[model samples]
Target: MITMQYRIVLPADYDMAIIRKRIAERGHLTDDFPRLAFKAYLYADRTAAYAKDRENLYAPFYLWRDTEGMNAFLGGAGFAGVIDSFGRPVVNTWSVWHAQVATDLSIATYATREIAPIAHHIALGELRDTEHARVQEDVERGALAAVTAFDPTHWTLLRFRLWRNVVEVADKNIDVYQVGHISQPSAKHDS
Candidate 1:
């Protein structure tokens, strides 16, 4: 599996309702898209009651079965619409080492992503195993969904998780967002 995300920082005064409406109206377009595992429509409002930062942003995260699906979406009109509205964004991608989802993914209301750099001396194989185990433990406990991926290009590891409720995280490197919608294209295969 592959994980991808692109963030677009909006103006401080930007109205976030526009993004909400956009998700409500078009988020389902990918519901049954081929080779797509899931798409999480996520956004953050600086003015929201639970916001931890003062920067508004529209960022969507995706899990794909392979590069074929990822490439198809990027070449499609849906992506074109995004470029038309927000200009082109620098998309970040990682090779997934582990992914687990609960039976009810629709209950996910919040999402968190943490990116950390891997030290030069660390064994990549061992690091991947450790992160995979951690994610399994998290999902077994109560996490709605969890994924661990790494980008060798930058030697960065990404830890992403979905929760059914709001969470208070103090880590400066972690980004939290409210989930507007989730498109599980391959719902039958989710586990």
Candidate 2:
């Protein structure tokens, strides 16, 4: 099976009430794509602040097992829109792909190619910034060690974004570690 993770960050000035309403409305409409494994709305704790030192809003985490199907679903869902936050629009979308190991390396190789560009781009922009350098460094070191110790089949792509107003009001920064892998099919593995 394959897994794809998508993350979207709302703008600082976005209307939380309206956004939540819209999300709720769409959630009901997602029945159109029953293949979607999981969808989650995540918010920062009241005590956390934005990493970019801007107002914070809740971040949305979406997951799917059918890569091609999910992409097609999103492409036609009319999910695009702009929100006002802190008098500015600060929205972004990011995605990651994951696939299980089969007898061949084709799946992993394809995922690597499809996901590497976005990962590298985000790493260069957000992860490498001075504000996030330490965290990025730690992640890189850990990721390298993990990859070395285990096969790439166990690895998964993780994409995340930060929202300003949501972070500030919610008083919590975005939490990437807890977003994906929540709905692993394996019952024994409680991801």
Candidate 1 residue lDDT tens string, 143-173: 8899999999999999999989888788878
Q: Which stretches of model 1 miss by more than 4 angstroms?
A: 188-191
**Which residue window of length 10 is worst by lDDT in model 1?**
182-191
For candidate 2, write residues 47-88 as lDDT tens digits.
233333443345544445556655665555334432322232
- In model 1, how large is the Cα lDDT of residue 97? 94
After superposing all C-alphas onto the true structure, candidate 1 shows an RMSD in angstroms of 1.7
State residue 45's C-alpha deviation in candidate 1, in Å: 0.8
Top lDDT model: 1
RMSD over all Cα atoms, model 2:
12.2
lDDT of each: 0.90, 0.33
The TM-score that candidate 2 achieves is 0.38
Can you give the lDDT of residue 48 in candidate 1? 77
